[model samples]
Structure formats: C-alpha cells, structure tokens
Target: MEKKRYYNDNIGPIKENEVLALKKALELCNEIGDITQITLLIHTKGNTGYLERIFETRNLKDFFRGVKIDQNYPPLKIETVRTFNDDWQGKKIVVAFGLRSNELHKYDDYENVAGIIAHQWSEDSVKDWAQSWGAIDLKTETEIEKTALPDKVVQQAFIDLTNSINMTTGITHPMDEEQCKTYIRALKKYDYELNSKEIFSFLTTELNWESDNANDVIKLIDKVNSGGYFKGGAKTGLQHHIKRWKSK
Candidate 1:
C-alpha cells in the first residue's frame, strides 16, 4: 500500500515576516547542534525591489556568509546539512524547503544515505509524515535524526510510560498472550506503521471505553485487563501499559 502524503498546501502565500522567524529557528538549531553551516542562494522573481528587499533582512545577513540574491526565480530556498548515520558517520543530511512551501522536507533514509556521503535529502511530505506521527521536524543532514524515538528507544519508552500508569493508578491494561504476540509481530514490520492517533481512534469507539487516548500495544493490554482509568478514579490516566515501561 502507498503511504499517505502527510501535508497539504492549504495555507496562503509566504511572507517575509515568516522568513524572518527563520533566524530564531537557526538559533534553535545551533543550540541543538542541529546545524553548523548555512549556504544561502536567493532566486527572486524579476523585481528591482528584490535586491533591496533581500539585503534588508538584517537577521539572515548576520549569520550567513554565502548570501546570493537573484531576481530571476520564484520564492527563496533554504537548505541545511546535519549528521545522520554511521555510514556517513559525521556527514551532513540536507533538508530543503522553498519559499512556495510552508514546511521543510527531508529525504534521508538508510537505503539513500548508506555509504560514504556528504548529505541526505528528504522532501517536505516525508517530513510531514514523521511530524504528524509525533517525530521532531528537524530537516537536517540526518534523515532519521529527527526521531520520534527510533524503535528501540520507543519500545523502551513505551515500557516505562506504561509501567508508571500501572503503579500510580494500580490499574493495568491487560493483554492476552496471543494479542501480545501479534502486536510484537506487527512491531517488527511497523513500529510506527500505527501511531498514537491511529491507535487512539480504536479506543474512542470500537473498544467501547470512550477514551480519546490509546496505543496499539497499550490499548490491547487495556482491553485484556478491563481495569481502567475511570474505575481507578482517573479520567485520562488510561496509560498503564505505557507508563509502566518508563520508570525503569
């Protein structure tokens, strides 16, 4: 099955005010060790105002050394390089976003950046998928660096969070042996194939528990136990399985 596209361009045209905010984003990136360099190439539609307009951006001019402003194209483009994998080791992963698009995009993947390379590229749509699923949107050199806690981390995080919910509320989401087995199999193929949003959908209607929050693994366990947040005197504390895995 084809993966769903993560974003749609419903927002209006881009504004210089918004681009100005890129300074703050750049600062944040530097703080997070997200980027070490900036290479600017401006292609502007034929406008005499373009030259002065480009130079007027005080914030962008200060940080970047390669500011090439052109009056021959559409909206401006921004790209970055950041570290991504063991193969490239310390290479940059390149993410690009254009003035026409409202969001940045990444194209880094193991299959794409699995060798001696300088950068990995990803599109805005793929970045959308990751962000929609709760992953950080860092369109740097490493494709997966902007992680929603890669599988191992997610698994361990899941365990900790679920465990905490159990202890605090004395409620546990019970999963039958078979359900757990099936879930593990799914995880092997798709740790993020299903996300909190998808899993939570099941909780609200199908489970008949009337919950707005759920997880594929934890929800299964919840159904098995039938011990719940409402019964435990907690409305949103329906996170037993996830919280439990977190404390350790």
Candidate 2:
C-alpha cells in the first residue's frame, strides 16, 4: 500500500490582512483533492492566543486537516517540522510559504518528505529549495491582494513580534535591552504609537508573569532606558542570532 503524503505550509502567525493568503492555501489544498492531507504550520515562540482568536473570527478551524504550532518557548527546542514529522503517519510534501533562507534546510533531513510546493510569498532561497527537488512553484498560481493592516492590528502585531523575540531569546528578567530596542525600531514600521508603559502592560499580560516579576521587569526597563540603551540607531542583530539558532 502506498503511504499517504501530507502537504505542509509555514503560515506563521496569521494576521488580519493575511486571511487571503490562508484562503488561497486552503483552496490549493482542496484542488489537490485531499484536504485531509493538508497541514498548516505556524512557527512562534509565543503563545497562540492571537492565532486562536483569528481562527475563531474567520471560522478557519474546520478548513484544514491539521494545525501545528511550536509548543516550547525560548531557545526553540522542538520545531513544528520535527514535531509534525514525529506525529506523521506517512510521507509529507512540504508546501513552503514565505520561508526564510535559514528555514529552507529543515525538511532535508526528514525521510518521509520528498517534495515541496513553493507557494506565493516564498523567498528566493525557498524557491531554490523547491527547484532542487523538482517541485512545483505556486508563485503565480495565487493572487493575494495587498491590504494594509488596521492601526489596532498593527499595534498588536508589534506586541506579538516583541513577545516572540523575547521568548525565543530567553529574556526572562527584563526582556533584554537589545530586544526592547528592536521592538522600538519595529514601531517605526507602524503608525500606531505605543508608550513604554503600554508596552510593559501588554508584555506582562501576555507573559502572565507574577506581580513581583512584572514589577522587576518594569524596573529593569526603566534602568535600561536610563542607561540610554533604548535610543537605538539600528535594529539589533537579534534577528541574525535567531536565524542562526533556528537553523540548528
């Protein structure tokens, strides 16, 4: 008997404007005539609260056969790819979506996986990976509209991005001065204004830290600000570090 082969795609955190992307992916899976073999993967070190809300809002829970997300926080011990393969009952054809250069190599070691679907928004390196496997590129197959995220959603995205960085880098005490700067730099991308106090409240609530720990974190942030670390020129090399760590 031939083993069933699932198709995988890295959806990451589904934002409001990215709903079209999700719909297109599902449509592609349906076109394959085996929606049951389609698995949507999200990679994040932070909690899936926001994603859960999105799933609920869009009624997206029933559209896919499997939805896998990273469970461990900080230091990224168990990636979704390995966890998915561990639980997989058969072969898998990875359908990469906007995969970064460092993330292109994760599927190479998996024995059950033999193909890739280079979906839209995929990076050049990801496309190259699919090409090496003689896989199909769905780049021009789906036409997703470019929509701007709402101001409120943009602010939330900023917070989520900050929390993800904090969790991945293992910044427990005060959320690492450099990481905080990265968050600040990220704010420049959005029109929404977030003060330090607002950021502190959002992060503490998101992390669900103890009262004492939250106070300590705020104090450290204040100290870091006093030391002029928040006045950053460029985004820190934290993303570079994350890429290197993720590839490992």
Candidate 3:
C-alpha cells in the first residue's frame, strides 16, 4: 500500500481495459479466499448495461452495486483510486476503485475510496445465510472512526487478528494519555479525524484499526499479553480493555 495507486473504470462507454481491471481484482479476491459477495457500482446508466457482461467474465457475478457516485457528489470520484489496501473479512482485497480516465482528478494520485466503500459494505447474520461484503478495501483509521461496523469489521478484525498470532511486540506511536483518550473517543464521533492531530495520530499509529496486517496485529496482541503497559498481570488486559471503554 506504500506505493502510489490508481484506478479507472469505464462507467459509460465501457472500456475493455477497465472491465479487465475490475475482473482481475475480483479474481484475485476469490483466489485468496471465498468471495461471499461483491458490490458493483457503475458511474453511469450506460455502464449498468455492462454490469452483467462484466460479471459474466468471472464468478464475481453477484458483488455488483452500480451507482453514479460522480454524478451527484464529485468528491466521491476521488475515491475511485483509493483501493490499494481495502480490508474485508480481515483479508486485504486486490482491487482498485475508480471511475473513467475522463473523470477529473481531485488529488494528485486520485485514490480515495477508503471511507465510501466502508459506508456501502454490510453484513447480515440471518442463520447460516449470514454474509459480509467489501473485503477488498482498506478502511483508514479516520474512516474507521466514521463507520458503525456491522460486526463485519469487528468479526473481520477478530479473524484477521486470529490468523496473525505470532505474538510480537507492538509499539504504539507516542501519544499523550489525553491524545490516546481523544483518539478512542473519536470512535463515537463521526468525522473525528477532521482534527489535524488525528491525521498525525493515524500516520504515527499505522492506519488505526490497530494494524490489520496479520503479523502486525498478532505481534500487537502478543506485546499486550507480555505486559507492554498494563497495570496488573495478564488479567490486566481484560481490565485495560474495560477501563479503556468504560473510561470513555
């Protein structure tokens, strides 16, 4: 994800390369694991006609939610490029979000789908029928604060954390106690990262959501277990968890 990324899909004229890009990302997602579902959004009504054909090229036939995000709100167009590290069900998906090349570029790079994708993806726990969507998008710390995880994110986080159990030391970016509290408190407030410090905190803390990378998270849990800053002993973890939440 460190590398600058770009995404462009032909929502109107239906460019072959755009379809190819989408197909490649979807195929990669399934190869990594079971793709329970996929949401497809088309930028234009014209592209809606192309949805069936796009999915027909592969098994991602169901994960499409077509939308004209660029029509109403131009800001969403920027999100087209921010698909480098999207995490769904704890797995980083190999997809890129984008509009057509003709679309305007708001940022220098054009990637910005993190926050929007989180909003659209969801999960339903109706018996064994329960399923989640959008595992291919990285939800930023600032973005995570804005979302109400459908147990999708948390369940994904749990699986993500469990899969990564090497248990190593996790060094949190330096933040004053007050800053940490504020960061945690942001969970309750939408648009929390509007504060400049939160952006810095996110950078320093490594994209929040407590390091979704399996190795990184496992080491973090390990560090906490090994007594990074807990008061008592192992039990202190549960206690700390409690205090962190209750104190809020």
lDDT of 1 by residue, 1-248 (tens): 11111122212223342243333334433443423333222222222122234345435433233332333211223322332222433222222223221122223222222111111122343333344333332233223322343344345533433434432222234433233433333342233333443333332222322121233344544543453321122223335433443344
**22-104, model 3: which lDDT tens digit per residue?**
55444444444433333343443333334445445433322333233233211111112332223333322223233321121
| Candidate closest to the true structure, highest TM-score | 2
Q: What is the C-alpha lDDT profile of model 2 across 1-248, one tens digit per residue? A: 12222222324444542344444444544444333343434454233333344466444433333444322211111124434553444444454444442354344434454343433342244433333223332334432221222245434544454556545333453445445445444443333343444444444334443333334435544655555344543465444433333344
- Give lDDT: candidate 2, residue 158: 41
TM-score of 2: 0.31
Would you give me the overall lDDT of model 2? 0.40
Candidates, ranked, TM-score? 2, 1, 3
| Candidate 1 residue runs with Cα over 4 Å from true position | 1-10, 39-95, 98-127, 133-248
| Candidate 1 minimal-lDDT segment of 10 residues | 113-122
Instruction: Note the Cα lDDT for every prediction shown.
Output: 0.31, 0.40, 0.29
Q: List the residue pairs that clash in candidate 2.
A: none
TM-score of each: 0.26, 0.31, 0.26
Query: lDDT of candidate 1 vs native?
Result: 0.31
Ranking by lDDT: 2, 1, 3
